[model samples]
Target: MSEGVKWTVLGDDDYLEIANNGRKPVKASLRIAGDIPYYGANNVQDYVEGFTHDGEFVLIAEDGTKSVDNYSIQYAVGKFWANNHVHVIRGKSELNTKYLFYYLQTVSFIPFLSGGGRAKLTKGKLVEIPIAFPPIETQNTIVSILDSFEELSTELSTELLNRGKQNEYYRDLLLTFPEESIEV
Candidate 1:
């Protein structure tokens, strides 16, 4: 553990799994009328009719393309519906949720993962993963820095996506020469 940090297991903390509130929504089922985000292992698959959880929480991918390799972790606020493939965790007052979210991003789940191909992060194993708990002030400071970076990242991602669309449009425009103008 780092200086002034207390090492603890997540299970021993106030974190709880609230993955079930209703039947987990499938991708197809999500297309129906809904206002809530339907969370999956790594991302929001779609919007669904109701929410299983409200307020702020951190969601870790239990198993998916990104679980073993990318260690996909997301911070969600407001109402949302999480599938069984995600592990929901809410932080205690001592431990900031954003800080936990940032800390989990640094973790490599490769060693802790199960299943040969699809890699699952079982709750049994997940709970035992050690977390370095610093004072609330330190955690909050780190969260502030990380949250700024995340905001910037989101802006860049949007810009890149828009640029890609523009590139595609220009490519299509330049390539659409008149059929009669073709030589040979």
Candidate 2:
């Protein structure tokens, strides 16, 4: 947080709405295969039919995260099915959902997690996370900066992949002997 700047603390519960009611995990054997992404504590565990939610929301791992320092956090949009392992939430009122999504990436979930084998972020602990988000204007500016970086990274990666393919094509062309000059 920059000095003299206003930041919203997590203690203010009204800033966000914890919408975990839609979380319901089905057994793998009973799952109906489809195009909808089925979300777990980490990532998409599977693609199945029937969506549990149909809006923009943030998902934090409820349990099964191997490392507390690198707990799973995802920004999901549109239709999706979430299991019991993830806590679903969204910004309320004037808060920007994407802004919170970006701010959470910089947060360390270690203090909020519990459990022995698998780290768990309970609803109580989740709300207790010591996070301070900047005001909406600053948050939107930060989001814009991060999004630009992400877009540029994607472009560089695609260019590198295309360059590799081009190199392989030229390498083969340079190494091969002409068929017309080869003796049978």
Candidate 3:
């Protein structure tokens, strides 16, 4: 609700570039695939031959895991593989990938998720989630501010750990006693 900006559904064709398809059945993939890798055959790719997606994407868990307020979100760049359990989405020209990643953190998936035994965020419902479409410059600015804060937080944590180690060393040095023997 700002000047030069309007609200739009995420799945709107004008701004859509989502990828939650191309995954093959695990049994079918096994017949054509090879070399499961050293990390074991747990990767979503193991069930399929080759990669399903390439380039930047904001991956959101589709099933099997959930919390009341949030779900797992991962930002992936370059080539990667995914199964039905994750939804790989990205922006085309109008949207920015990093901006979406940041924005999704504030979204609540509980409203859109379905299923009784296992929660799932289906593709049909995901496209309907409303998103803010501020100016491109604003999106970039927000990302920059957030990134700077993250970097500073990491630096402060490291400094605190170093100071704790120094405190322990000084305490030990001050407590050291001169070498002496005592008779009982």
Candidate 4:
């Protein structure tokens, strides 16, 4: 996508759901062909479904108990959903979702969230938020790299957990062996 292209907000597609308060909920099903990283507002609550976004996009929290200061939880695209609480964005051929997601992350757009009871993201401010899109290829490269890092991190975490369990098992086994010293 190029900067010259036109862009539109969630309202344009009728996807914008104005909440009673001033926030929206991130709720959408996403599906990526490859190792696309699926994300959610509170975290990975679910996996991608059939529909998938090819390009990059921005995800802003719309409604929730948590407070987001400037698009804190944003997701780049390989394939994912914005969910109900989040606003998914696309630049008219000019920008990809990844670029927008990254740009929003740098700022705190959620400051506008307001609602005594049920809060929601205001459509007016959301559309007005400025974003910059890098070249599509660049966005893809970045997402790919980031995905790799995320995968590695996840793997490491799992490995660490397994190690912890193994250590506990050995400790229990040694303790069961009556010969082991037991401090009074």
* CA lDDT of each prediction against the hidden true structure: 0.79, 0.83, 0.71, 0.54
Pairs that clash in candidate 3: none
Q: Is candidate 1 or candidate 2 better by TM-score?
A: 2
lDDT of 1 by residue, 44-131 (tens): 8888787778888888888884635568898899998888888888677788888888888888788778888788888888887778
Per-residue lDDT of candidate 3, residues 84-181 (tens digit): 67777887687778888898889888899898877778889989899886787788888899889989999999999999999999999988866774
Tens digits of lDDT, candidate 4, 92-115: 444445555555567665555667
Off by over 4 Å in 1: 1-3, 14-27, 156-184
In the range 56-148, model 2's lDDT, one tens digit per residue, is 998988998656777788889999999999988888665778877887888988877777787778888887765565667777788899889
How does each model score on TM-score? 0.77, 0.83, 0.74, 0.55
* Model 4: residue 13 alpha-carbon error in angstroms: 10
Instruction: List the candidate numbers ranked by lDDT, top first.
Output: 2, 1, 3, 4
Among all windows of ten consecutive residues in candidate 1, which has the lowest summed lDDT? 14-23
lDDT, residue 2, candidate 3: 50
**Winner on TM-score (1 vs 3):** 1
Order of all candidates by TM-score, from best down to worst? 2, 1, 3, 4
